[model samples]
Target: MQFGIFSVSDITRDPVSGVTPTEAERIDAIVRIARKADEVGMDVFAIGEHHNPPFFSSSPTTLLANIAAQTERLILTTATTLITTNDPVRIAEEYAMLQHLSQGRMDLMIGRGNTAPVYPWFGQDIRQGLPLALENYNLLHRLWREDVVDWEGQFRTPLQGFTSVPRPLDDVPPFVWHGSIRTPEIAEQAAFYGNGFFANHIFWPTSHSLRLIDFYRQRFEHYGHGTKKQAVVGLGGQAYIAKRSQDAYKEFRPYFDEAPVYGHGPSLEDFSTMTPLSVGSPQEVIDKTLTFHDSFGDYQRQLFLMDHAGLPLKTVLEQLDLLGEEVIPVLRKELDARRDPESAPAPTHRGLTEAKYGDRPVRRPRPNANRGDNVTGASPYQDSDAEATYPSLT
Candidate 1:
């Protein structure tokens, strides 16, 4: 299992300090946070996308690309890449650029985000969110895999001989994980493509997430990717830790009560009991996290929400220290011991490239001299189909 942290990128006032971090402060703090995760041996660092206030991460690729330049081993990804709203062409182009810049140290998790108003901001409709997600991803998947795409879709203008440039690093597209909270269609989509399914397991009970995961596993195997145990899965969670259990609760309670996500609703204790929110000592956190495997079975990735609800950067860094030093080490050992031998490993760039190419030379596309337009060159229909259409591989 891979363990790491993801931020929703909320810039809220600290309940204890009664001061909100400036956008500049929050942005800088996030970079520091990501660096600290890498320093502490965490495996991944992800940031969410939100186009509205109380959140700062509208452009996740730019932020992730910056972090990619700064960190060595940590895999940078998005907690939620809005597949419904963003143009699939742009996603294919931008993320492919990021893949090149990071040297394949990145992947993306796509979801129809929770915010409703984000639809019209990008000239989409919430009612069509499901189909939008499905259609857009269909196009994106083709964009990355095919050298020249001739396509038309319900949501976007038709494409004729379009190529998403900077072709995926090493001719292998970045791995994709379809993230969903309650939608089974998304799970079905992930399973159909043999892609990873990520359940945002933060808000709901373990049993609820279990149903979605189990369905995904069954469908994944039904689609003949592999056995259920071999299906790729990921779960989200939240945690806060202190030397003592009481100290953990006392420090985190105020923020929990004020948090816009779950605040002014369930008591922190009830929330923790019902969901995957763990607020306790290191041992307590480890104990709670172990139960996730018990409930969800063998999974690949585990990401926690630690920087939201106005937690100060200093405090958040302290939590990461505890997580890296005290919590994850133990969890890694225990989970490794318990994991099914037949289960899949966490997705990685090298793994995908190797899976695609094996010992053969990797393909490097070299386009013909510019023909002033893409329709006549490097397109599948070039020269009335008398010759090969794809760019010649060097």
Candidate 2:
């Protein structure tokens, strides 16, 4: 199982301090957080993209590329890459470039952003968001796999023999996770392609997310991917922790009350009871998070929203330290023990590539292949004329 932190990059005032971080501070803080993730042995660090107010991550690829340059092993990813508005061509090119820069430690989630106004800002009608997501993703998939594309779509201009540059590292595209809060269509899309389905299961009850994941898993099997359990899955969560449950509640209460997303809505107690927001001791968080795997079955990734609510940078880092030292080690062991290889397997570049193209025969060197080529540095397989005089060894 992969574990990491995801930031929406909300620039809100710290309710207790009455200080809002400058945009520069927020951006710098994200850098620090990502480095901390690497230092503490986290597997991934994802940034959410938003174009509206109170959100700093309008350009996730730029930010992730910067993070990628600094970190060595962490898998840089996006919380949401807006498939509804952004052109698929741009996403394909930009992320493929990122894949080269990162050397394959990258993946992304496709989402129709939560805000409705963002559609118009991008010159798209909100009503056509679903169709736009479907069509755009279809094009984006082809852009990665095919060397040349000649196609037309409803939302974007047609392309004739268009080839995106900086082909994906390792000849494999970055894995995609379809992130949806409530949309089953998104889940279906992920299943149809045998991609990962991520339920941002923060706001809703566990039962709701279970149903969505179940639907995706079932359809994934129906599409001939594998059994339901073998379908790729990921889940989102929120947590605040302390040595004692009381300290956690006392410290995180003010932040929760003034949270930009869910503040002034539900009591902290109500929120914890009703949603997945667990503000308590580390063990409580572990207990609740384990229940998700139990209910939804083994998943590939688990991302936590820990840096939001305007917590101080120092506090957030401390939280990460505790998570690295205490939480993740245990979760890793438990999840690994429960995972059945035939049912729930980790998604990997080699696995996905083999699944997609393994059955196809390897093309042998043609008899006249590169016959006139003068390059002396060519591989023996490409030395077709030399092969006639001397049989080549495998």
Candidate 3:
């Protein structure tokens, strides 16, 4: 299993102090949080892509590339690479280049972003989001795999023998995870291609996430990918932890109450009881997170929303330290021991390649016996055989 932190890059008021961070501060903080994640042994660090106000993460690749240059082993990823609006060709080229630059430490998740206004900003209709996602992803897949592609689609012009430059390093494309909060169509799409499904389960309750995951798992098997348990699954969570449960509540309550995502909605206690968000001690977070596996089975990746809601860099870094030191190790051990081998493991470039191409036998060139010259000869098998002959019995 892979453990990591994801930031939405929300720049909200401090609630208590009524202070809002500048755009520079938020961007710098995001970098700082990513570095802290690497320093504390987190497996991955993902940044969300948003274009509207109160959110700073507009270009995930730039941020992830910066993090990639600094970190050695941390997997750099995107929480949401917009599938509906952004050009698939750009995604294919940029990420492939980033993969080479990062030495294969990058992956991305695709989604139709939550904001409706972003559609027009990118010359897309919000009503066509699903179709856009499907068509764009199909093109993106082909751009990564085929050297040259001829394609026609509803949203974009036809491509005639188009080849995306800078082909993926070693023919390995960044692994994709389809992220959806409530859309079953996205889940079906992910399963259709045997890609990872990430239920951003931070907002909704466990039952809602369970149903979405169950739908995806069933569709995954229906598409003949594998059994339900073998379906690729990733989940999202949120947490605020302290040594004592009381301190956790006292510290996180103000932020929770003022958070733009969930603020003025459910009470903290009510939200925690209903959703995957944990506001308690380290042990409480462990226990709550364990319950997810119990309900959802052994998932591939678990990412927490740790640095959102304008929490200062110092507090976020402290949270990372606690998460690294107190929570992730125990969860890793337990989840690994309980995982099934037949199930698809965490989505990685190497794992995807092995699953797709590892079993094929290597073809060796056969030498020509008739060659009198002392030169290496090509095999007869190099060309298709029209027929086989048998020697005469005479």
* Residue range with the least summed lDDT across 10 consecutive positions in model 1: 377-386
> How does model 3 fare in lDDT?
0.85
lDDT rank, highest first?
Answer: 1, 3, 2
Q: Can you write out model 1's per-residue Cα lDDT over 65-145, one digit (the tens) per residue?
A: 999999999999998899999999999999999999999999999999867888998999999999999999999999999
Error of 1 at 29 (Å): 0.6
Candidate 3, after superposition: displacement of residue 183 in Å? Answer: 1.8
Q: Residue 325 of model 3: what lDDT? A: 85
Scored by lDDT, the top model is 1
Clashing pairs in 1: none
Residues 217-283, model 3: lDDT tens digits: 9999999989998898999999999999999999999999888878888999999999999989999
What C-alpha lDDT, on a 0 to 100 scale, does residue 100 get in candidate 3? Answer: 78
Error of 2 at 314 (Å): 0.9
1-394: candidate 2 lDDT, tens digit per residue: 8899899889888888889999999899999999999899999899999897788998888888999999978899999899988989889999988887887788988998758888999999889988899899999989887655778988898986566655566558889999986788888999999889999889999988988899999999999888998899988989998989999999999999999878999899999998888788888888888888789888999999989988989889999987777788788888888887777555655565676569774322322233354322222233223323323458
- Against the true structure, what is each candidate's TM-score? 0.96, 0.89, 0.89
Total backbone collisions, model 2: 0
TM-score leader: 1
For candidate 1, what is the TM-score? 0.96
Candidate 2 vs 3: which has more lDDT? 3
C-alpha lDDT values of all predictions:
0.91, 0.84, 0.85
